[model samples]
Target: MSHNAASEPDHHPVSTAENWWVFRGPADLPPPPSWRGIAGPAGTPVAQEYLLSPEDVAVVNTALHLRRPLLVTGRPGTGKSSLAHAVAKDLGLGEVLRWPVNSRSTLEDALCRYDAVGRLREVSLERERRSPRGASGRLRYRSRGRHSDIGDFLRLGPLGTALAARDRPRVLLIDELDKADIDLPNDLLVVLEEAQFEIPELARLPEDQQNVEVLVTGSRERVPVSRGTVTCDNFPVVVMTSNGERDFPPAFLRRCVRLDLQDPGEEKLRDIVRLHLGDDALAEAEDLVQDFLQRAATQTLATDQLLAAVHLRITGADLSRDQLINTVMRRLDEAFPA
Candidate 1:
């Protein structure tokens, strides 16, 4: 029943009956045929066969083993978010819990929400329907479920799921920490330190059943959660991404292990293209990628722009380098404005 790198087939048909909610047996979720080619120490890949480096592998492995948050800073299209998926896949961790941060995001957004207002409205309507008749045939006020507490509808959020999952370590992707407000990161300090967060609605439940555990992610918005700062005690594996838009506060930098991602070399890009496409397509696309990379080096384009060109070359009607270069340059202008 165990999956090994060599024995598994490259492609297997998933059952039509199988769905995300319906649990698949172990036999159903076999390893990919080329698993061995991608695996490195600690179950992650040494390189993504193209983009990663020895330093990148080392940093990722250390974070995975030590269970510390690994902060990754890079320009856009440097593959920050993809690293989370690669780690999860390597470790046999199921799916990643992605918490995309933006302005106006709050701790409550990360934690569970108590539908206090909704519950009150529901109770009010129920009470009005059941009230006894008063003078002039008007109904007198009598409460039905008004006494009911709002805590019943409180549900756990991403952070709650991570803390509670003791069986297997979950991969939490906090993408674009810079986009969030200042208070968001500060609010996360408590949960990261304790490895447990509280849902006020849980007070309605017995003390034992009220708390939810989960992993958390923050964007660079620098939300202030509390006056006093907190640090992780459990050493939960945290992955934070930055697009290098702004400089972070000194105090915040002190809390994390930071790594900067460099652009993938030509050989690595070739490997990646081959892995995703085939050898024939890779040969045709390599020169175009090199040109794209040259532009990227000059700060004239982004990695995504390069990827788009490769994708178009592989799938487009004409696989010529000229066609690809023209397509990519056009996309670059649309994606990145002057």
Candidate 2:
């Protein structure tokens, strides 16, 4: 079914069995309504809630023992990224520190970013707000050697935050490393091996101002920095994901534990469906699962596409199940008629 405009959402939890082919749009747009493919619940499962294969479990444990990044390579929808969350959940680590890599990503950007311009502007404004000019037409701050703390201008990125001293290890997810600039993987070798990074701004601070509280990327919480350097008390568990976009340098590959995710089988797919949708929907939806498996043999179809198709199926769709499957399972290159 074709919808005129996206319908508004309700606050209640999405029931596995929502009535579909029913109107959700404006009063003018009635009956045989479009599918609500985008209407899933808001948040994803945490680390503890995720499912991991035994092979994946073995490789992840190896990386944990060796203290190396686990590099995950897979096709789209193969759970390459979710592996990080599963590991964090299983280990009871706090929120995963995620660094999403792209073409512009760099090692320095990952470690820390100092906003000098923003700092200069704020400092100038702060001086005026705090104290008025004296007879010499110069501002006089109250008993000041350094007017504002340098730590205020500095913030650590995800990598840097993971490296900061903490009671326990943080789980760091470096997502899509293959999408990063060519040198990024190689540049990561030192940080991965050393588990430490220095903030030059804090490093050069006067001895008296050496210890400062600074901001980190994800938590946005300030942590104490000593002598401008950060060293992990516990080495972080690192997971890096890739879509098989490109090859990594041999030296870079040598340092990382690799895990390659394959598409889930029929049994695993049914289990996944049961986990996400519900047992109520699984019986009828299993029919689509077989259809999806058939198409997946000839063309690439992500697990998510199957989920979306199933999500619509469980809803009381006016359209026949076969029609809905044919419409939703189109190849990536297949185009819909205008």
Candidate 3:
């Protein structure tokens, strides 16, 4: 049954001003300048170098020197998460092993995941492939209970992969730890100090099968795990970001080096602008940057908001200041000043 074109409903009549959308059907835009879209030839994030304050640099270095996790706390868009990317990129560490935390996230989930059901299914299939049941003595004799390879059913997560990397330290970004369960921070203390984790699935294997090769999160290649234990030769650079939403346990906080990313100053803001938007956009950006700075003082505003407005303005969007305010430069709290 063929349907007429008019039979289908329109999606809000294609908007009153189609050109208002930067994501229209014909005018697809690339990713934002501040974003890293994909992996490069070197198998790392496509991020450019980012600036950090002198104090932040010192604190990061202290964490590296002490072989402790760097706990970065700050407001939104203050570069807490960006610090991990910058460190990983500048240090020639391969792709960062990022563990995005949430209220339901578990330590086991970040370490590794085992597909028990998949392994069981594989074993059942193997059993089915045996000679037909009750046909002959051979049929019944061939059906001994045997399991599939456990390695095929297990994959190491980001945290596990970082601890397993032996050549050099990989950067482990534990983003938004404040959103994690209250117990999570304390749970991480032992792992951060030990730099190793044991996989009980592999541990319970036969004495002869002490070692297994398993897949890791970001790579297809399997890494050899001896005695079911993955230990790092060098401590990984662990960076945990918090948005000042919660306080961690004293024990957890004691093991970490703390760094607070303050709001970028005028000089730092200009550098960030130049780095992301480039020199071509800089000439027309000063006034807008000034406007953003002034507004930031009065209300909660992020640096990205300024970048967005500047991006639209320089693109010849013909938007008025009032329009920009109502749309792009709205306060992070979603309200205008009194």
TM-score to native of every candidate shown:
0.67, 0.80, 0.84
* Residue-wise C-alpha lDDT for candidate 1, range 107-159, written one tens digit per residue: 77766555678878877766566768744588676754444433334444565
- Write the residue-wise lDDT of candidate 3 on 1-338 in tens digits: 11111122111112223354565444445344334345666555565556776666888889989989999998888878778888887787867789999999999998889999999998787766664764354555454655458898899999888888878889999999999998888888788777789999998898999989888887687889988888878788999999999888888889999998888789778776666666656677778888888988878788778777777666655477778766888888765559
lDDT of each: 0.58, 0.74, 0.78
Off by over 4 Å in 1: 1-51, 125-152, 204-236, 316-323, 329-338
Candidate 2 lDDT:
0.74
Error of 3 at 219 (Å): 1.9
lDDT value, residue 153 of candidate 1: 44
True-structure RMSD for candidate 3:
10.3
Best by lDDT: 3
Give the candidate order by descending lDDT: 3, 2, 1
Ranking by TM-score: 3, 2, 1
In model 1, what is the error at residue 80, expressed in angstroms? 0.3
Q: By TM-score, who's the top model here?
A: 3
Worst 10 residues of 2 by lDDT: 1-10
Q: Pick the winner on lDDT between candidates 1 and 3.
A: 3
Q: List the pairs of residues colliding in candidate 3.
A: none
